[model samples]
Target: MNDTNSLEPVTAAAVYRAYNGGYFKTLVSPEQTGGSFALLEMVLPQGAEPPAHLHEKEDETFYVLDGTVSFRIGSKTYIAGPGETIFAPRLIAHEFRITSSQLHFITLLTPGSFWDYFMEFSTAADAVPVVKAPTELPPADFLMHLINRLNSQYGVKLV
Candidate 1:
């Protein structure tokens, strides 16, 4: 493990724009964490349905900061609100949808390399919108194939 003294506080985070018109702000990058983990703040608009998928390389944990998110992990479903947390271990099929007008949450991915998925899928943005308006998603049939194709490159499998 790297020395603790190597770590520095992040007072500001850069915003990234996702395909669904939501936002992701990386709080602690893999480089900052010595490749052990990456931390991000996610601001998702309601009705965003992330395709069910499983990571082959890393585990994920979500901590709700505000609003709610409905998650399906394997066969179980959970609704998380502020102050709640959920975990999806590697190889576990999990999907989540923003259930409130907007949901703000923190995401932590262990082994950090998997953070590349966000880097690959989202791009730097000007800001994180306060009133998140739902964006129209692609058709489900088309979305599944698209997610499968894109996620595969990152060792994430559509499930």
Candidate 2:
């Protein structure tokens, strides 16, 4: 049964690999329901990192599934290993890096619709021809475009 209903416990095996970077998958999103929450599984190979970004209208929570990850929430950073969890409230800048050999984790958003924005960005990232340096941020206009598109499509304004 799908996640919205049924007495059967949802299994991790049912999580679908997401389109962004082929490194993440989803167990549920707003697409599953009008629910205001989303959950994701992030697979970070050694040295992998997600560009630093923040949410203006949504809060994010991370629960480590395996290995160690360096999570940067605002100016503070910490190494979060398996069984560890981190939360970044709305409007706070955050980013992360896979510090250990391999890292896996589950990230949930306060509003499920945020997952729609994430998937959209991830899809754009996969389709984009330009390569981003490990430390480089996307141009402000590009980020703006992505955020705007997300706001329009998923009903989450990233401003």
RMSD of each: 5.5, 6.9
Error of 2 at 7 (Å): 15
Summing lDDT over every window of 10 consecutive residues in candidate 1, give the lowest-scoring window: 8-17
TM-score of each: 0.78, 0.64
Tens digits of lDDT, candidate 2, 1-159: 556565776443344443323356677776676767888877656544646766666798999988788878889998898899999887777887777766678998887767766565654323212322234456899868866775566444432
lDDT of 1 by residue, 64-114 (tens): 999988999999999999999999999999999887888889999998887
Best TM-score among the predictions, by candidate number: 1
Residue 24, candidate 1: Cα error in Å is 1.2
Off by over 4 Å in 2: 1-15, 18-20, 31-33, 121-159
Error of 1 at 63 (Å): 0.2
